[model samples]
Target: MEALDSPKLDEHSQALVAMNEVFQRQRKDYLANPYPDYTSRIRDLRKLAQLVQDHKDALARAISEDYGNRSVDETLFAEILPVLEGIQETIKHLRKWMRPERRRVRQLVYPLASNRLIAQPLGVVGVIVPWNFPINLAFSPLTSIFAAGNRALVKMSDRSPRLAAFLKRVVTDYFPREKLAFIDDGHQLGPEFSALPFDHLLFTGSTQTGKAVMASAATNLTPVTLELGGKSPAVVAPDFPLEVAAERILFWKLMNAGQICTNIDYLFLPESKVREFVELTQKIAHQRYPDLQAPDYTSIIDDRSYQRLWDTVADAQQKGTQVVNVFPGNEGDGALRKFPLHLLIEPNDDSLVMQREIFGPLLPIKTYRDPQEVIEYINSRERPLAFYPFTRNKSLRDLYLQRVMSGGACVNNCLLHVAQHDLPFGGVGHSGIGHYHGKEGFINFSKLRPVHYQGFIDGLKPLMPPYGEKSRKILEFMIRRARS
Candidate 1:
């Protein structure tokens, strides 16, 4: 099947046309049966599980070609593993996930028990996936969509051109084009995809693009989930373990060469603890992953992103800030973009790299004697998508958790929060909007319709007539109870 069926933006894709046709059929089935059937959803997930396991090699190969040489090991662990795990977890809990939750009613509806929420699937959804981890990003949230029993039309990244080609093949072979669809063009059809009358839309990409998506979604009044980037800070008070914090930050900061939305964007350490944390990370770098070019570490996604990272370093250098060299020979212009990793220190807030989300392998450090000042810095900017504080001390983690507002939080580590199937994943403020994963993931793509059933008995009708002894007594009791 052709990846892009439309010759121009005005004309849409044949794949997309085929997708709309499928939606028409699926929509009929959906309206006829709005309630989710947990068993059928589980069956579909089993098929998806088989597809991921069977196409593991092809998926990895495609991702590697897109990254020019991102190791297959990296793709398997980062992309394939997460997708399978999310699907598996959802399948294991589908029955419970589908059951209508019961909530007690007020005294008025005595003996007429109420089922609080019936999670109904949205008719159709559009998922805008990022290029960083094409397979995982596309399928992870998709698991919840399936678990909720909804149809999805996915827009694969144009950056991952090769992977797009391969993913399209896999998508067509296993699932009907209407049940599941993939778009593989250079963002030309993105607006059309977003403007489709999907019940809900989920977009994972940069903040700038997220804004555009929001504008288009407004046209149809479609509710959306935007998982965009931010300057997500990692704070380590004096109480945290220096060695553990260093290694934990390094693993995530360097993951996908810092092309992660929730990766530690920067760090704030106590002035007294700065030297100790920095030195320990330097030691762990040599001991744990001796070679900076190890197979486990993937390169930056594209040349444009690589150059953008280097530009941040250059701007910082011009402003007289010191750049922390994490990898040997990963210095100067020649090898910088090819293998980028840096521990950056700025003179102050005025410094260049300290300004915005450093979406690269650069880790900017700031020493703070007062944690409140750091908290103020966080609030000063737009709320972040995710925040981290690597501290074993309960008080410290709790303090940050209580004071700061973000999409999600992880204590003593990073990025692990996103994978926990029990929690929700999303952003706040300018970082992005809405979150969907696990139970929350399912609900985000569903409509929680409340059906209130009243029995034949019209008891408690005394309040409607002229006030009498029983009505007056009940009204007085209710008022007193409400005050108390």
Candidate 2:
């Protein structure tokens, strides 16, 4: 026979091959152990929490390295602490969540049958994590997945290579490759990763990318939970205190340099309060970040995002909007990607900053004379991931709450609802499609299988006969019983 050479596989092809192999291994493992016991699931969760505890500093450092300068406190407060707390909450509830519920038997079955609602594992789940809040986004869902007695394969963002690599290396110590694996984006394998036939998939990122992920997962008939971003709005009612609202909003708006998905994208200030809000924000911004170069302030994720923010400000200013730089004359260090916060006072609706989601430290203010205007304007667009109505007035608060629809909301505040482990965290409409956190998280990742057990009595015996008068009479009685 003549010697023949094998065809060479490109990088993506090889990555796909490796991913498929891991997927198959996980699938096979799931088949062997379809439903893990509570003890095993608890052990898995503990390992996850321990992994974070042991590697907290290193993980924070790697995240900081990924961003030119991510705040250490922000990483710990936003990512590390929240994840650990979520895991603890999941552990506390897993036992109750695992128990099957006794459902009432249908009247047709009567006393002859029993019904049960059992939550069973849904095999391996794939988690597509985003660069922002990488740790919490990845492991918070993982907490739910594992608590539901399922394995997972996490794909990390390309932008956070260091954290991805760190996770890939450390996750192995706690879990076998078949149970849990972290795949790096070294080969840009996000599309390939989403196409795998996992039991369920959870993706967290931009709305556009979420659509692509949903389309990819559809091919495999895989269910997905999308945590997408939109221009989440905050309205400061006239009844509310402007300075208090200013302090709270500014804290979250600048927490991750306004890179948060649920961060207030635009603010609706009462027409009379615009200038005071601007002045308060300027004072707060300067006080909080006196020197933009200090480590207390985080840099923009990359140069492209940094440039995009600056472009947005320029476009707004060119359109005659009043742009107030919180730190005047100190036009941030471009080398460090530290772009100072700019308050675009009443930017035009056509302006770039207002038209799109500003995922940076730029806030656009919109003046509103009536709450109805705020309601009408927001309802006209895609539903947001979050809505912030900062007012203590019960009627006004209830008015906004009843009218607006969003993935979630934080009254009198912003961005704190996501940190609550008890509440399910996901998006709505363009914002996202399903939820995952606490009990809801467990249910999202599991299949709620219904089980029926037949008893000694056979309720249908009298009805299952030849078509005759007796059968008709029994059916009539049954119908009357149903009506009753």
Candidate 3:
């Protein structure tokens, strides 16, 4: 199926020209008035926030159309609140955050050298959003971009052109096309969008696509924020609440129909408690949403995703894995995209569900005996964008936190770590590069300038004179003393 796209989008060639002009203009404009000067920048951010705030309902409505059936309530809380909150928080903290950092003077130039770290805005930033959680994912990096006082050009996913159009309208109303523009297009434009020589780039999507975006960003050596997805996993200890854990996990697991980047893709349960956990999970999911494929229930994002969910279930079933359907006729004939709520059982790791990420409602339970076995299981795969463990036990949580590494993790819950605006959000290995949200977000979009102001006493000035025994001895003495 073709993805939704705006008819108003400038064709690739024309879009390229517009962006280049904007980049050059903004670069000169920014150079003329460095970002550290807050008047114009703060004015711009307030305008942008007002624009977004005024159009909140329209944005949510458009997104609901694109997703076929999206949760407007969830979108408001997850997407809109976060973006506005980011703006508020950034405004409150920007002055202190942008203040120059002081550094210790080196002994070699103790009296002569004064060191400082200055913050500078990385010029134009490019942000590409994914269809799922479009506004939150899109505007999130905007927080950092504004915090660093950089102009931005954004490209909203064509899959959600309705929402893109809504954003494009609001943004254009408040921002100059040069200061901030939104490009709405499909696959034909992905490569060219990535090729822009923005000072920084942030692309949020699949791991495979993130690689391509990174490669293109490298053409200009632009640093990239790759918020890529991997099969993020959740582990449930034997001591945790089976019913509550299953309910909470399945609640979030199914949010946006499991299309979320930080969504728990797979689960590892305590070996001895596998049966109990599965039973509870099935009961809760059934009770919560008896009609799993109804209009209110979120459908697969698109047909390709629909087929993918189908394939995962089909392959697992064919491989002799038990596919449980708690609701009568939950599993369909595979004709319509409303396939089934698959409580797929892969008693062995070799099954299809176990082989890759199930970015759908299908939950495959993998059992682990030892706590170390769970850690080893996590280590075996590429690092996840988000790791979740549901255990109230402090010691086990601490042990897991120290041993297992992920982009961001939660002990008693899943993915909520990302919602906390105070923590830095990012992945470690295969999930992502660089951090965003809170303080790290500000740094990610900034160029940290290491500055050293130097003036000399006559004694230090002699060290820079013609190579003489006195200078050499003085340098040696400084080096030795510095090392000591």
Candidate 4:
């Protein structure tokens, strides 16, 4: 009789198997040396810094190519610089973060016991990065993972194939597979990657995909830190200068063509200032981006995204909303996928532009009567990732800050809080789950195990459950003292 043949695996299944093999190897290596010392972690971080610095130009070019016309300055400032700063901050504070924290023992066990929290390394971490700011999202979390002394496996977005390939090559050159690995097969293996049993997982993407990733991670009981996106709003006070607010909001709106997760999705303008705000925004936009065809202006990521923006604008226009293109005559170089900015005035509540997170150069302006109305309007919807209030009044600032609920906030600026190395950046509700940046990032990837050390003396020996006469008398005395 002929021998039976084994079942053949498909390409995705084979990829899954290969990924699991790498995970198993990393797990084994982590078990062998569970905790890396401070010096070793610093060395690893320095190497990563060098890796980014040495290839900054190449990485920028690759990212620009992926987006067709991404601004090189934007990539350098928003992506590479933040990652380098995060690495340096991690190295600077790793020694302190790794030291065991001394905690106070309970009064009941105070005599012969002491308590402390040991920041132990979680064995393996999995990171799923998005196409926007791919390098920053990938390496910023990697800095924390390494600082926490854990191994990591990263899955890059399929939309950013060039950057993904470049990262894979550079990362492989710098570190071993057991230490750090990048999965650049695009989305073909994303489900398998999320299903792997990792000690911790961090995903940065849209809320819908974040939910799916969370569900996949649930099977393994793995903890997750999701950096998802939502409709973040910018509230401009009636008292503040219209030009300043418009310039600030417009600056962020056009950054990377408004692909950032925390970009101002809409504006809350006092009813009177709406017209002036629009005029100021148009002038600022024209002066800043004189020619939409210029390289300084970023293009939409792809045809699908480009068409989405156009459709959103059209839907708003059809719904009786006034659509204003900041650069009217300059439609941008269509061949390069660059599109001009569109500002929507009072779009219908049910319009696509108003309902969804417009991750593009489309801005919606909603008028408000009072601050309380603005607060209620924001609270009625799902919580956003960021809330920007531009006001000079201290009371108004405090009122908005206190009333509005979001993952993070900016007093008078936009998109600057996420860049702070000391801040914990994450979302709440529909926005995101947990945080990962600076010290919070370190703690997020670590297991804070509480340890109790006992001395030779046993203070509770007399209170043992023997139902003896001495035990009863002691318990009665303690109860009386507690009551008194």
> Model 3 over residues 24-143: C-alpha lDDT tens digits?
776776677666477666776687678769988988888888877776777787888988987787777777887889889764456666888888888888998888888888778887
Model 1: lDDT to the true structure: 0.78
Candidate 1 minimal-lDDT segment of 10 residues: 331-340
Candidate 4 structure quality by residue, lDDT tens digits, 1-484: 0111214765566667778888998999999999999888898899889999999999999999999988999999998999999998888888899999999865563476888899999999999999989989999999999999999999988888998888888887889999998887654888889999999999999999999999999999999999988999999897888888888899999999999999999999989998898789889998998878788999889989888888888899989999888888766566888888888989899999878889889899999989999999899999999999999999999999999999999989998999999999999999999898999999999999999888667778887777799988877887888899
Give the deviation of candidate 1 from the true structure as CA RMSD: 3.2
Q: Which pairs clash (backbone N, Cα, C closer than 3 Å) in model 1?
A: 6-13, 437-441
- Shift of residue 290 alpha carbon in model 2, Å: 0.9
**RMSD of model 2, in Å?**
2.3
Instruction: In angstroms, give how far residue 42 of model 3 lies from its true place.
Output: 2.8
- Candidate 1: Cα lDDT at 308: 74
- What tens-digit string does per-residue lDDT give for candidate 2 at 227-259? 999999999999899999999999999998889
TM-score-wise, the better of 1 and 3 is 3
List runs of model 2 lying over 4 Å from the truth.
1-7
Please say which candidate is ahead in TM-score: 1 or 4: 4
Task: Mark the regions of model 3 whose C-alpha exceeds 4 Å error after superposition.
Answer: 1-12, 15-25, 293-296, 332-340, 347-350, 456-459
List the candidates' TM-scores in order: 0.89, 0.97, 0.92, 0.96
Q: How does each model score on lDDT?
A: 0.78, 0.92, 0.78, 0.89
Q: Candidate 1 residues 334-373, lDDT tens each?
A: 3323455788774457665677677677888887888798
